[model samples]
Target chain A: MQFSGDILIEDEFLRDGLQNEERIFTLAEKLEFLAALEAAGLRRIQVGSFVHPKWVPQMADTDALCEAMPRNEGVTYTALVLNGAGLDRALAVGLGHLSISISASETHSRKNTNRSVDEGRAAITPVIERALSEGVTVRAGIQSALGCGFEGRIDPARVIAIAREFAALGVQEINIADTAGLANPVQVFDLCRKLQDAIGPDVALSLHLHDTRGLGLANMLAGLQAGVRIFDAAMGGLGGCPFVPEATGNVATEDLAFACEEMGLATGIDWQKLRAPVARAEALLGRALPARQSHVPSPPWLREVA
Target chain B: MQFSGDILIEDEFLRDGLQNEERIFTLAEKLEFLAALEAAGLRRIQVGSFVHPKWVPQMADTDALCEAMPRNEGVTYTALVLNGAGLDRALAVGLGHLSISISASETHSRKNTNRSVDEGRAAITPVIERALSEGVTVRAGIQSALGCGFEGRIDPARVIAIAREFAALGVQEINIADTAGLANPVQVFDLCRKLQDAIGPDVALSLHLHDTRGLGLANMLAGLQAGVRIFDAAMGGLGGCPFVPEATGNVATEDLAFACEEMGLATGIDWQKLRAPVARAEALLGRALPARQSHVPSPPWLREVA
Candidate 1:
């Protein structure tokens, strides 16, 4: 009952959502999504991932995305960078906000990059330093923060240790990811609490969860109980890891916003407005999006109150 | 930290699972699904709903299903009854168990069944009494237990009152349903605790959650945490409600069981064997079932151990 008011949510649909599309959109189509994100009152959006074009052809437009993004005076548009090279490319395109990821599971880290987790960490630390040097706000992500399909359960201790390193490296934020949908509410709450305890409130705690096990929103609510103010979600549940194997989309942005808003927690988002991005993306994907809010009969309140 | 084991999940594919199929399965196909359910190690299942053929033509084969169901020892096959007439039909068909539903949201009750919550309750209480006299196990359900699209928020108090009344009527179980996916972990945990307070351990607590908002498994976890056992899920997530309009499928039974088994909980159901049911349903629906576990490769542990 104590939980109320608008909470900040970060939309990862562009970077995370584009993973599920059968047909990769033109850079223009991708920007259409970004413009919709801006119009939806979303304060933060991850527009593109800086992975190599050869590896993920869908995200080949990352450089162009940064240049073409709809500029909102207060909105934070982010480019997800892998290492220093990706960070440099994002920075050269006038991208001032950045996210770098390191997998908590060693197996996943090695699969994601040909390096071990520690090596991935070694690679990302300098990007954090460089982002700070360039005055680019950096949010360092601990992928597989909850569990891994390849390696199974990830150690919360490793996640905490990584967060401490990121905090020390002056990363602007820390996003903990349950990359494999293996997280439970207790684990999510516990991890968020521990990460916050280690890093304090200076770094925002952003949670990225998957719907793989039906714990996506449950885990988000648990993190909310642990005082996490930020979340990552996709439009129309479009996004999954090309590497995480069975991974589906991130928690859908509109669904998350609806849950938070209806529960009296403010998401600063209009759920009705959030549908546009997914609808736009549907043209690119051909198939309908996975899950959608029920279309039950007209709510009398919507008509009467308004 | 106390939660462990595979959660006990009951597949509802036969009864509530066939709401909007383009074509109803013949008694033979339905029998095949039941066959798969038994092989999946399902100890409990809802095989049919005794509603009017005109109202729900897809379920017109209720009596046929009762006759053709593969009789397996110790597997509890239940049927849904909407009114006294339906209950009479179920009793005539020799159903051992019955599930009766009353909505927590008055608006939904009126629109869905042309009765207010109290009137719907009135119409069903005698059915509960009549079923009990015949030694049939009657489980009362509070539908729209979370929130209703038409009604907005469902008061936990109303749900408790419905649950309390049903418990007093000698019902064998109480199912708290997120008829709409408007529940979060907090709401689920809190509501389950209240439901337990109203019904206690003598009457089993069941959950019928829809994945409309992707919170089905999360709500199920909340029920488990609150000491409620027994869950209702659909195979391959193949369901939507023609009654409610655009309702998503029940929680995926395989996905739920996998989550539960991995956590070391005793569900007494075989997770691996349930894949066939999913496959059969997918073929029947002429589309892929919407389940995360379906897309996943066999875990290395399973292969290594095998």
Candidate 2:
């Protein structure tokens, strides 16, 4: 219940945020966002994903975007890579950090990757091994680790098994994703505690939460109580699982960062500066995003009286 | 951290929800919502507020709506009354429960009711006494109890003093409202715990939270952790403080109930059934509401497989 300590927030705006939008963002627009995000003091950012253009048209220019990204000291840029081809693309672009993920739910795994959970695990293991062997920092993720749209109530033991597998593969971090956002605070706390116990402390555990059910921040609180320090958030709360029914955005970066700052946790994020990217995204999308802090000005209490 | 036991959720859709909305709903429409809420197993419902029509045009027909409301068994219907005139109106309407509230912040008090904090307190003291004399169930509330948008941070001592004043007057409940939605979970927990210690167990403390910065549910969780059981929510998350800029809806009734049920707490609310009223509200308002559960279909995990 006591939240004290520093937390690392990984902004996935350019990747997860833009992947689901119908209109594909040009390279220039993405670079503009990247610059804004970097300028906002986000130390960790997911630039984009190495996915097939046929699968995710919005992410077709991930390689080009990565090649054009400016290398900044003290900033870690990551990208999601699903398969061997995606890994090859990431290596070709000389990306240092790569996220390799598979769904914990069999139904979700097949639907998302066109492979069963076992096949998906088998496929990602080699990619993870290859990435780690090449000195690339790998973050292995278990998608739908909490629950699934097609498959109900994913077992915690299964998620723990995947986390253990990822840990044994020598990944730097393991992420438990509430891909469908079917997670409550109690479940999040219990599952995160169990995962922490299962994986031990050497491997860092991160949470990728969605706000589909409005429990995203509450769940994040639970994760914090359970000893998680890394979280994935998107600017303007953009991003959703296309395969999941009625899936909304990830927990908004500004909102999450604001909560962290309010809780006395050091996130090294200038949450106020995040409004620029969110505003730009809103303009490009031609609609107001769901991020609450982005739309509402900070209350007087949060500001310094001159 | 442990949230167990039964909780009381007072649905304020008819009162708080409609107050800030631009279009005024007809009495028949309100009655329909009342019936829907009742049928959805909501035992406590705030029908509307007895206020000047010039101030809140949406609640003009509160007395008529109260008159037409069916007297269901075991149901507690309440109305918000701001002053002597509003109390007289409630008495004339033969209402059994009334909420007399004042802002804890001086600036908010003056802006909201045209009275300073002390003046607002003095003005409401006689109304609370009169209502108690009439054997009316009274809920004395401190608006902006946690933080104020205009005045910034409200001192916790002020809120406790007001609660003590109300308790001394034999009020049935003390409600703490985050009118500006600026409360963080840590502050909410610490303050609620302090208030509980100050007030003792005889009087119940309920939380009235807004989702302005997307922290409503998280703050609710903190309240639960602090051992305060009663809460106020609105159908489809309808409601915002007009005095507070960019204030969004109250915590969604369905979302709050869903979180409770998922956490193994009994709320006596048929959350799925309440979607009917939410759909109707959205239709009438001509916009999607902020409630997450209402917009998204319950995932397969929540539904029983036939």
Best by TM-score: 2
Residue range B1-306, candidate 2, lDDT tens digits: 567789899999998899898888999899999999998889999999998988888888998887888888889989999999999999998999888999999988988899999999999999999999999999999999999888788999999998899999999899999998999999999999989887889989999999999999999999998998999999999998767765679999999999998898999988889887888899999999999998887878666621
The digit string of per-residue lDDT tens for model 1 on A1-306 reads 347756888888888888556578888787777778778788888888888988888888888878776678989888788888888798899888888888988888888887898898888887889888999988899998888888777778888999999999888789999887778777787788889999988888889988876668878877887888889988777778888876876788877887776556887776666655666667667767754541223233443522
Isolated chain A: TM-score per model?
A: 0.95, 0.97
Q: Lowest lDDT 10-mer window, candidate 2 chain A?
A: A297-306
Residues B168-262, candidate 1, lDDT per residue (tens digit)? 99988898887766677668878888788778779888888887766677677667777877888887776666666646777888777776765
Clashing pairs in 2: none
**Highest-DockQ candidate:** 2
For all candidates listed, what's the TM-score of chain B alone? 0.95, 0.97
Would you estimate the TM-scores of all the predictions?
0.91, 0.97
lDDT of each: 0.79, 0.90
lDDT: worst 10-residue window of model 1 chain B = B297-306
| Candidate 1 error regions (>4 Å) | A19-22, A294-306, B105-114, B298-306
True contacts kept of each: 0.41, 0.82
Note the residue pairs that clash in candidate 1: A5-A266, A6-A266, A7-A266, A239-A249, B4-B265, B5-B264, B5-B265, B6-B260, B6-B261, B6-B265
